[model samples]
Target: MSRIYRHPTQPTVELPPVDLLTLLFDSEHSLAQDDTILHQEAANPSNTVNKRQLRDLVERIAHGLRTNYGIGAQGPNKDVVTVISYGQMLVSAAFFGVIAAGGVYSAASPSSTVAEPARQVKIGNSRLLICGKEHQAVTTRAAEECGLPLSSVLLLESSPEWKLRSLEGGIDVVSSSRLSWQTITDRQALKDSLITILWSSGTTGLPKGVMLSHENLVAETYITALSGRQWAAKEIEKGNELPAVQYRTLGHLPISHIAGLFGYLLAPMYSGGSVVWMRKYNWEDMLKCLKQYEITAFYTVPSIFLRISKSPEVTDHFKHLVGASTGAAPMDGKLQMAANAKLGSGQDAMIGQTWGLSETTGAITMMPKGESDTTGSISPILPSVELRMVDDDFNDVESGQEGELLVRSPLVTNGYYNNPQATKDAFHDGWFCTGDIGSLRDGKFYIVDRKKELLKYKGLQVAPAEIENVLFTHPQIKEAAVVGVPAPDDPGTDWPRAYVVPVGPDAVSEDDVKAWVADRLAPYKQLRGGVMFVDGELPKNAIGKFLRRELRDRAKREMGIKAKL
Candidate 1:
């Protein structure tokens, strides 16, 4: 059987073909009747940019990029400018401005250490870095290492000495509008021109520069707005309506991320909703923001959901919330149910859950507004997207069987920047290999695990997520990860081991933990390899996905054998 997904609206509708800037600020697309697009939380007291203010600000920055740096003077050249900051008011402006000026900006996480950001600067070959004061030292050092002058570093703050104002003061509308910003020759030019480069979270290895075009982003924004899986629409359907209440977004994730860029930022902007910013995330602060903003839609990762779903504060604090989404990592059926039960009501209320990679822009599969899904099952594929489940030889798998996900569409990225070999390896025929294991049933998709991350124990493949899901059911367990370690006595065979972070200071015996699982699973599936406990949180990437490879290496070191990971 062949499985392909098409959006409900795909047949009659097509995404507008224009540059990202035109899509964002054009009068035709503005959803805001009041011209508001950003909502600054008290946590970020000094930042707010409405649609008009934001447009002027982006235009001003676009003018500066052209006049000072001549970034686009050569006509759609790949002069990369790096933006490293949290979701500041102007970071949005900088993002659109760089593209508006015909230069592409790469989004780097503020959580990046010296080596990571430095490698990005080198790979991007960035001529200038737009950053914040918080990561000043690391970025400055990275710029130096990349042989870029200190003057190439631009801060995200106001500088009267330099005649530049923070987005905080707002830009001069007249002066900004006067600047003749560069424009593409045609819609085709805009569609093909590069707009932004975002880094892939290097779970397996080094992060690659994923280049996305104006058409790619514009399509993603439009599809999200039209998609029934979009959380904001679900919120209204759940009876959270109020008089003159604008749809608002609460985002604590880095705006530089694809999820942050699309689901949390651009889609909301495209829909004429305001985004409330959070500089950093904590469960307690998240609870406070829910009430303070009466935030209708919330998009976050499963780790945060795990903590909050189990917290006493969820039902009480999240009453005003219309919908909740888990991203960055997959949520198990058990945890997904708990989250939906708390966040949802009747047959609806819970919204958002789909999957995408940097290659597919943001989300490629989303649940329609009127539907619900199983714990691990994500919604059907988007209408504008085409996908397949293929076996090791690239032959199509049966619909109900697991295989690597291969996707094709305008939503797919061109390839990694400056790496032709990697670009070639990432594609087969016209399809981009997703590196994820998945299966389809009734148009819904289930992500089994990463192909490379699957563990072999006693000739059977074990998904770490499967064991981790069971661990989550244990009330004493706060977080858990499973990895296969080489049997100490035999290098050829492997056995499963679990690393856990307990909820509190209370002691949990290893044997007791092993016994709890022994009765639940087959003897081979038991934790016969043993259990190890960590005093702190497990190592994770910026988006909260577990770095399981790191855990395997740690287990190798502890056992005093050079175990192959």
Candidate 2:
């Protein structure tokens, strides 16, 4: 029998007969009264954009894309617009506008090196690149490398030397003579359109693009919104400081990242919540904003939750929180309970955790609100979502037996954008094969380990292949292997460890290798687990493949004594 864990409170309401772009703009007047988008400026982040302004901006940008770039203007085949910027009003406008004008939109992380952006643009077939002023140089280089016209690049702000180009202003001017597009009433058209291309760092090798139709996104949005509303009802029933639960959410998560994009940004907006976006994450600034805005909800990872659980100031600040929902890595139930207690969970505030993949379009399983026992039991399969625990042979596992999870839902992605072989291999009988190993006990899903080789370091997915590729960039490195071992200090977090074989006598030291990697990769991808200079060839099997498990075990024996970075 196929097991399905449905949410108790999630209602099956009639879905709107429109696309995501239409849904955002077609809000109730009462809900749209307050500012929708907020970002940090300094100690006080008062910068905000209301719903009306967001709608107008989308219209302007859509018109500009159509008029200037002939993208998403009026065509059956929509062009792709790649956005490389921080989370802000402009980034939101650029993205929504592309979809409004019928263009495919993809957002790339600014922290990523040229290779990542290049691959996204080339594979996504993006026509125009929209970048922020700070990242103009890298964006320009990436665009040139990808053979995208420099003229197609639009900067978020105007500059002097590089010629300031305002994407907002240019679009406003172009669309001045044209009326903004009305809501697309055609439900079937909206369902069929490919609105976004979200990339995933696959289990091995380069990141693969995941194409999502507007319907796929809409389904998740509607389902997630119902859950949020139910949570608000629970908060009200339990007695909240703000009287009833208000859906004011924080958006410090990266706009380009899947967790940030749907879990924090779009999903909250869909639920009639205002998102306070931070340009970049700063612990102190985040602490200030949480209190200043009287934020009702938080979607974050366990590492930050652990930090908050320790801080009295942060704890005192979030007294009115409805809940803190965490994912991306393992969360300690005790730590979550402690954090919730501080956030006035005594008043019935909730703390939660979920398990998901980019292939499933954010989380497929969620921990029920008001629950203190995390225990990796993401409450249910959610409405219309089905789960099955299967062994390596794809046979169903017995109760309490660990097996890889297979997910089937309307929100499940169609497939990877360009990789048919991968798509074909990952799915069976309508279920998307989730590489996570877990068991279904009672009704809730309990995760144990992942069958895939992808590493999770502090809630961020760190692919060993990506780190090894960067290691190969070093001249002194001959053979390189990377693995994720438990961080010595942090109980649940994992740290990326590098094991290297030197090519010459003048080879780099451990610190040198770490520093080089730090410079090249993101801070989270750093070799905090310490780099070991291995002698002779690295551990391998008969097929001559580098054995990461041997290196991982060696890491525990050698570098496990080091203090937390």
Candidate 3:
């Protein structure tokens, strides 16, 4: 049973067409009719695309899926195996196929820590496990540990030994047979069934996978295209018949991350746009690709922009880009201003930023381009999204007052994978708890902080647990507790601090440790608060939870003592 929450104020925006796939195809068709093919295909789009051919391509994928994956089939009562659980490539394919089949593909972040697997599994309500070869071991280990059987697991990796075996069997047989993504059909997803499993940031405890249907992703993508009107204006100004937005996106964000998967891959490709991918982060290579591809739109974290602004080569090469969209992390106003200056005068890129979570499909509030002081202002709620700010008593706050942001949207996940208690807590009455502290002023959303004790620097959100996980990755570190300490009189709200128990005398120094983290994480999450070597264990709560509050208070006391001395 699905619950619908009517907003205190009804949505005033025009409802977008429900058939998003049709719109994308039509839009492409319109582009073709007007001879507005992107720069690459300006000469001859006969090699590029035609609407009927594109639709046929989709049909082919659907046909392949039905034949290969046993879609719309009646089997011998044996639980059929589909690999939508693991192998990011399969997950991505599943997402598209599901959309094509009118099913939703759940959004699951691959970077979730080990402690979060069971919670994600339960929240997702997904029984079938789909994964590629590289992630099979980890996925299998977690699924089995969570009591999911071997029959439920589906392997999509290509191994020479198992080339001839069929994929419709138990886990062992499938593993032995080695199924490649190429073998799977592209359009076999069940439309009405749950397609996606979006999860919360999972900064505090376990991550809950939110269930999303095919309709949800399509709906959101359609609205996103409509909401960004300034980009449309740019295209009109350029004398193009339709908006000249190309689908060239930088695909550096993890496939599991919503921004990476949907925003960069699905949305653009659905619009007949192509994306440039990076297996790993290479700043220079990215700039080179942008210039080489003449990427018109840029989607990434603010930290990425900051890095590019600092890199002379990026500015030199990517000056032709007309629009840029930043999300996944908050962009500093100073940085935003700097970026605009670096890009120079000839091309005024429509720089925009947005705020969202995995549970909301992708974006809820976006600061559209041409808006001033747009750094932290996570613009108006989308047509489908409703926002409410409540105080201690759960009463709505006055216009200027601050409160916890409760969001309700069709884009909201069905619930946490399997954790009913967590789900109940997350979805109260009708609104889903964003767990983010924010304030709405004149319809603009400004995030204050997170309900959980996670630290965010720049645009890259830093989960304290992820940092702790990284700490344990070190050979000499025994126990570690990472916490956010509020930066005093600083522009950004918080800075991350880590307390670690060392196993030996010659452990890495604070600078060495910070440098180590810098190499892994984006620039904003650098451990600038300085590492402290603790003698024993960190202070804990009754249930063995690290009392981060105590650490925060201790830091304050130390600062006060230093001032007194």
Candidate 4:
């Protein structure tokens, strides 16, 4: 029997079975319809997008895609449009526009190499490619390699006014034409309809596309926001003064990832918040924006918080910050407390920790406002989410015992896109296997370890198997294994390190191995943890499987001790 755990304090609420666009723009739940929801940071008058302008832009882009590009001529979700760009206010338009045209949005990292986006483009069978001006070089090559014509590739420019035009200058998105997204109320259709494809590295193997639906996004947005909404209501009922903070945040993370997708695109519209877009993440620029925009709440990773705790330039930037949360990687308890101290002046602000994966859309567990936990534990499960801890035998464990955490929620992805075997392997019964080992104690959850071999560097997923596959292509490498070693400078982050048995001694140097990977993979996937040439062979078991645990332990012991010296 399984001992399932539901949220202890919060009750489940009914989720609307409408399309994502309808829920955001046309439903009773919509907020900030007449207010500014998107802003460009550092602009003189700060280019802003109200709800009406956003809807008009989305409709025009949808019409242009359908009439000019034939995106949805065959109906919805069949056409995949790939977008690669950094943070910009207009990127949200591209996202909704694709969905409004009954097309699926496929996001790729702007920092990706030619081969990376090319592989994704081929996987999705993408019909059209879109990119920001800065990434035109990489997108051009990727589109060419994918055999997509230059006419099918569009450039998204935001500076001198928002425009989506073809490189050949034949097609441009204009406001004269408009198309509205079909309002969906059928529960089954909402559950089955695919709206976005966000790539994630599962427990093992190369990166796979995670397919999310309208139901998934709606459930995630509603459940994640419920606690805060309830708290605000109760405070008002008691006639107590609430914090005088607006729902403003800074968008400094990549829009391709789940955190950025939900935080920047979906959540703000529902909460009546405003997001100030940063073209790319710069530490100094981010600090200035926080103060400049008077950002009240933000979602970031542990690495950025680590910087805030140590950097002298962090003072007064977060004085107006009332809410802060960190995820994507583990955070030390001391570091969490130190970072919390830098938040709002007279408020009882705490930097909460959230835990989830791309499979869960964004967060399954987050601490509610007015609560503080500095014990390195991810807070309570959100409303309507069910959790279970199961041992190796598939039996439930006691409350305090650690086991592989399984979750059941509408927020979980349907499965990996176009990979039936992988999808089938990801679930057991009706529960989604999270590949994380964790425990539930007194209504709070603690993630003890990752059963999966995936490593997160600066909140980006880096699969060791992906790197090893790339290494095997090198001529001089015989056998190779990769493991994550703790980064010396950045606490609570891991960098990929490789242990290699070369074909011969001195045949391949460390720089040669690093450069080989840099040329083939994205910058985040590069082996910053350095490479070591092993003497004989990598440790293996009786069946000749590489003992990665031994390598991980050795790397940590050797590398961590050396850093101290």
Q: Per-residue alpha-carbon lDDT of model 1 for 340-419, expressed as tens digits?
A: 66773524537457788888997888766656665567676777788888999998898788899998888898899999
Q: Tell me the spans in candidate 3 whose CA falls farther than 4 Å from its real position.
A: 1-10, 13-92, 98-108, 112-127, 140-193, 229-245, 310-313, 343-350, 369-375, 441-443, 454-565
lDDT per model, in order?
0.74, 0.68, 0.55, 0.83
297-358 per-residue lDDT for model 3 (tens digits): 67776545654554455455656576676766545454566566655352453566677777
**Total backbone clashes of candidate 4, pairs 3 or more residues apart or in separate chains:** 0
Between candidates 3 and 4, which one is better according to lDDT?
4
Model 2 compared with the native: what TM-score? 0.74
For candidate 1, the lDDT comes to 0.74
**What does the lDDT come to for candidate 4?**
0.83
Q: Which whole-number lDDT from 0 to 100 does residue 65 have in model 2? A: 75
Candidate No. with top TM-score: 1
The C-alpha stretches of model 4 lying farther than 4 A from their native spots are 43-45, 201-204, 346-349, 453-565
TM-score of 1: 0.90
Each candidate structure's count of clashing pairs: 2, 1, 28, 0
The sequence of per-residue lDDT tens digits that candidate 2 reaches over residues 518-546 is 89889888888778787865774211246
Q: Would you list the clashing residue pairs of candidate 1?
A: 7-383, 333-375
